[model samples]
Target: MESPHAVLLVVLIATFAICNLVQAEDQEGFISLDCGLPPNEVSPYIEPITGLRFSSDSSFIQSGIIGKVDKSFETLKSYMTLRYFPDGKRNCYNLIVKQGTTYMIRATALYGNYDGHNNSPKFDLYIGANFWTTLDTGKSITGVGEEITYIPRSNSLDVCLVKTDTTTPFLSLLELRPLDKDTYLTTSGSLKNFRRYYLSNSESIIAYPEDVKDRIWESRFESEWKQISTTLKPNNSIGGYFVPQNALMTAAIPANESAPFSLTEELDSPTDELYVYLHFSEVQSLKANESREFDMLWGGEVVYDAFSPEYLNITTIQTNTPVTCKDGKCNLELRRTKNSTLPPLLNAIEFYTVIKFPQLETNETDVVAIKDIKATYELNRITWQGDPCVPQKFRWVGLDCNSLDTLTLPRITSLNLSSTGLKGNIAAGIQNLTHLEKLDLSNNNLTGGIPEFLANMKSLSFINLSKNNLNGSIPQALLKREKDGLKLSVDEKTRCFPGSCVTTTKKKFPVMIVALVSSAVVVIVVVLVLIFVFKKKKPSNLEALPPSSNTPCENVTSTSISDTSIETKRKRFSYSEVLEMTKNLQRPLGEGGFGVVYHGDINGSSQQVAVKLLSQSSTQGYKEFKAEVNSSSNFC
Candidate 1:
């Protein structure tokens, strides 16, 4: 017979060994068993039961048919309408997968008619929960099938089966099992600590007295000391994951040249890399050819420090890794191995790096500048009595550019001056502008003859002279060669001359004079010639006439009464001669209803000569004026 105590000891030892073997298997066997051989490539997935689903695991029931599911085991479910067409994939569900883990999923259909129905449609299996995409691998099955060893992300994943039915279908269930993404030998280690290091990252950065700069500088070093201290705090740093025994650091200063700066204490080697913490302090870009202090350690104790005389540049953090630990916290710290535990005082070591950047300079630019911007136009608001156009801001509302593209003049070629209270004729000085295009002065209180000088503008295009108080025949010479190339448009009250659109009768008299004189001049000339030809010769009427006589036209007599006409002939002279006269049209002695008197030099003597243009272009002006001049006649 065996001893009872001895048998118990043997059983206990065997149980412990078995437990270890199972743990090793768990670590190694957690990968999908898919070899990609047709039927061997199994799909891994499980579906939620009793809901509207488009997966192969779901089936639809008609009014009289009831859904049947055998809950051989307990499950998670909710009752709802089951409506999903397989072809359209309406009401499909999703599966989540961990980033770096493996899993196996399988599904099979237990098809039986709830109301003694016919055969249901087929189903397709898919494994992935990408809402934007669908998985390519799965089986089309009418019967039950088994699949194994699917993969999950590093954490968890989902698998699904889609009902290939043209109509909606209900599902029983889909099964999923975590699997290994890669093959590995069985081994043993504490997952708590391994996971921490695997999850953490290592980084360090230097600041320029600014939080933004501090954040940017904290990306260079990696070490275990930082990972533990950063718990329960905000860590958006890139290297915020798990870290090991290694450490890497760098130093730098701000760009201010005149700023008085200080240095950081020498790095203390506790266990090789003892006081390793990231800070947003000064930053320096070290050169690759420089030197830095590097220490080494083993078994939680410092061995040696590899320090060079030349300060070094830190391209990467260099330190011993894979430090032993039991948990993710401060399990196996490699702090300054045997040195004093006091924290480093910044004022002690006085060692750091610095550089200076030059200040920026600027220069002046030459461009057209704006100042005291101002503009004016007519505003026809009856409510506001004063001229509203002068200051455009306080004006009639609609008297502006139709689109109001800007506060300035209209950029287009058109202008509208309709219904404005303009009381005066267009001034002659207005024609000084050469670029005036289209003009509208309709519905205004203006009265004047259109300026004949307007006909001299060659760029005149479209014009409207309608509904104004103007009364004048269209001047025939406006289109005539002597008048220029422009045309005029007019009706009862409106007139357009050159580029100007006259709005009233104020310009009508001058317009009529031009029309009559230019259009009827030739006819009058014929009548005058006939009169001169028919004149009879007088015998002896010559006698000594008084020096200053008032009679001149009385001397020459026209014979035929029917051929008499009082038509004026126009004379053209050099423009330079007119400029010389009246001392270049300046300083007129007097201007009146008849003509003008100017101080002029006649034979080197300053004389007050009255020069008459006689309505500018009168038919009888030349002869009468000359006769009066030659006879020294002064009705005065």
Candidate 2:
């Protein structure tokens, strides 16, 4: 070791030489850390490339790959099969490192297994639980080991080796530490669906999904940096963003000063800046007589020059600055920009942004769209909106759609459009939905008789015509099914005969099958008689009409049609007739997921019961209670 006096003199000479050489460059302190005097000591059994080795309190480490081996600097004899296992290619290393320093830990090992039985091992580098990354061992006989990086956010992180296959050689080591940092930035973007992916060393190998609200980026160098930056372009779908720590978290700068990275760091809004502490090696291959200083550039322009040709503090180097000098180290910090209008680029020299974006607009049902299916009520005001509808947004409280099939003409079986602070007559267009089984428009300022078209919907099992200015006679067909206990104050049963029938809670199963069967049998007999009478007078060759005629219609006109007109007409039941048949009663079939279904007799039809409900309690209960009542869960 040189004496203190001698070392002081050497430092002064180096500093003076550095100052004179960097006259045209940015004047800043430069430094570097070195591996003990060995040109190339191959860790044939371990990771490649050294990284930013700066120390910090909140340690965040990423890893890198092993670089190509140099013949002269190679220490192959020293490379022993530290943990040789030929079957599964499984190997482990116990890396001893200091704590409270942010590190990017990357390991690159050559794969030697080629048999079909060869499988990748699972390996992890840990510094307690706070720092660790797991890599899936792979089969790569090409000698380029699978590159994976990890950034441990905690303090007790450590590294662990995994061997997935117990058959092939455990794990082989070839190249080591090819990169300098332990984070990922996909220039073309990340592996889709992966929550987090990192690359060992310099290559941006990590890609984290923006699905989460907060995101973290780790430093790339083995040495700490003075500042760091992450930039993101604006995108509603890109996601909201965040960074882990500020510069106050650790040491001011990295040990390496060879070169550095840049990041966007300004926001019109109140945003924080990143302060990184990076570390890298600044090597200078010089001849014994060569003593010239060299200038260092990051992106382009020179930051500082080194007389001894080594690393410098390039942290303050402006964007595009040159990291020109050889045999020197570098570590720098860049800032991130939020919500910029610029085009999005993952590797635009320097840019990174992780977002947590939210979804907007959920409810947008229109009433004017359905005009044919009129209800026995006035159609009125539903709030208007221009935004597109999404599921969890847009304040659509009580509009539930059929679940079985979400697409197709939506089955609007239920609706609770009450007290939306809305004003108007119930929309007549609602009856256009023939599938509507329930309707609740109570406690609103609606006037006029309920639309008659509502009765046309064969699926309507429940009705709520209460607390409105409705004056027309209640449609007896709507009363066929009793729902919630209703007020007997209104005469909802047969008004054509002036209270001709009092509807009862007792259920009734239809016997209409007898009439249908009898009618079919009668029609068959009548048709046979009429055909025989007409055929008696026809010629035997009457079957020939036209060659291309689709239907076998008789050529007989008005004169021949009148002979059997009565028999041709089947017994047709009018709308009023079906209503009269429900005068009889039966028993309850019990309630289902939707409502109470009953076994009722409509004229002679049997086993034709209905799902019935009178009124929803929640509408008058809560403004949004109506949507829940229309639970698509029953069918969807």
TM-score of 1: 0.17
**Candidate 1 lDDT, tens digit per residue, 1-636?**
111101121232332332332211222222221111122222332112211112222221111122542333122221111122333332222343454443434433333332234445454433332111121212221223333333332232333334444534433334344433332101211011000011123322121112221111112212211221221222223332111111112222212312212221222222211212222211223365532233333334554444221112112122222232122222111122222221111000101111111111010010000000001223322222211121233232322212232233322223355566555665443343344455566676656676665566544564555557665544544546234434345564444455455546757778987875773454235324423432332221111122222434233243221243212211111223333444554555664442344443322222233333323334454345345433432221
Error of 1 at 622 (Å): 43
Residue-level lDDT tens digits of model 2 in 158-231 = 23343334432223331112122323322221111111211112322211122111122222333333322223
Alpha carbon deviation, residue 460, candidate 2 (Å)? 3.5
Candidate 1 regions exceeding 4 Å error are 1-66, 69-87, 129-143, 153-170, 180-636
- Model 1 clash number: 86
Lowest-sum lDDT 10-residue window in model 1: 364-373
